[model samples]
Target: AAQTDAWDGVRALRADYRTATGERREVVLGDGTVLSLNTGSAVNVRFDASRRLVELLAGEILVISGHGAGSGVPLEVATREGRVRALGTRFAVRQQDEYSTVDVFESAVEIRPRDGSGAPLLLAAGRGAAFCRHASGAPHAVGAYADAWSRGQLIVDDVTLGDFLAELARYRPGVIDCAPAVARLRLSGVFPLADTQRILNMLPNSLPVQVRSRTRYWVSVEPAS
Candidate 1:
């Protein structure tokens, strides 16, 4: 589930860490920075005399800066949207198709948009924000359970069935189609990501929907007849 690839480039040694679907991994970089990757996550790392940089290519990661070989230099994590400069802090970053989300758990972080158009924004602890190439949203309070997934649990509070399934899909393989007719049903609970099948099985007992599995790779939810 965890793979490491390294190669020497013209400037320095570059390493790539990736986690497969349904897998979570933790990696410690040469500089002592710890990265906890979520399912289907990947991070490319490079360190030199000048600076330390981490490129988040896909999925989500929780970063904890460590005092190690390269601890003197500032560490930056970049996504397509922009860059997040860690200020001796712990934070989480998640990449989307057109944007990226950053949640600050301790201390603060400085965000700079990729387009270089807007002023850099400072996000403090207990805050979360989203940004794209052109714009960044205002910082908002992070939910208490925002970091639950890192503990192998998914916690939802009055979330629609559709929204919850979309999130669950990230930790699962293949497709899980939720019918529009049942998408608006609301539910709240803490489900263990390690046992996805158990969560699917319990859905029928709580919600007025039926789970139909055509194959192990394909499943659907529809209104129970």
Candidate 2:
């Protein structure tokens, strides 16, 4: 993909930040907004007199509004699908393939789709929603471990093996593939993000699966022999 300058408008100063695989980072904006970027995430910060905006070019961010200079300006996190306007709150936004997910942890947030086709939705505390270009899903209760990644942990609650591996792949440098035969196996555990290889090694003991490693950068989970 071609990289375009994020600060292309007049008087628009922008800063870009990114984290490589298996890394997490924090960024403080000029207006006192702290953003926690997850692994392999990228964000663009643009602040001016009129608006305070953080664009999620890729990945997820946990935003906490600060109360210092330039704090009164409403903070908005823009994704490909839409924008999440912080309403004196703390929230997290993740940019997905087809849509973006917003989870509110404190206060409320207003979501506006990019195409401006549907009514804007206000998500209150403890709620989450997904939105696309022209529509949005209704707000739902926040999941048990929706924000656990920020703590360097993966909390699984009877989630499918494939789904768990898919999430785990986001934190590592290479492929972690699950064979089709074991994809539907159920799993529940707390896997530490600090050691992804250990997680792969321990899976076979707890489940009917085998972890095959072609190299450190390539691995696969298949039905146990």
Best by lDDT: 1
Off by over 4 Å in 2: 1-15
lDDT of 1 by residue, 148-219 (tens): 888899999999999999998898899999999999999999999998878998999999999999899799
Pairs of residues clashing in candidate 2: none
lDDT of each: 0.88, 0.87
Q: What TM-score would each prediction reach against the true structure?
A: 0.91, 0.90
RMSD of 2: 3.8
Q: In model 1, what is the error at residue 156, expressed in angstroms?
A: 0.9
Note the residue pairs that clash in candidate 1. none
The C-alpha stretches of model 1 lying farther than 4 A from their native spots are 1-15
Query: How far is each candidate from the true structure, as Cα RMSD in Å?
Result: 5.1, 3.8
Each candidate: how many clashes? 0, 0
Supply candidate 1's per-residue lDDT for 24: 93
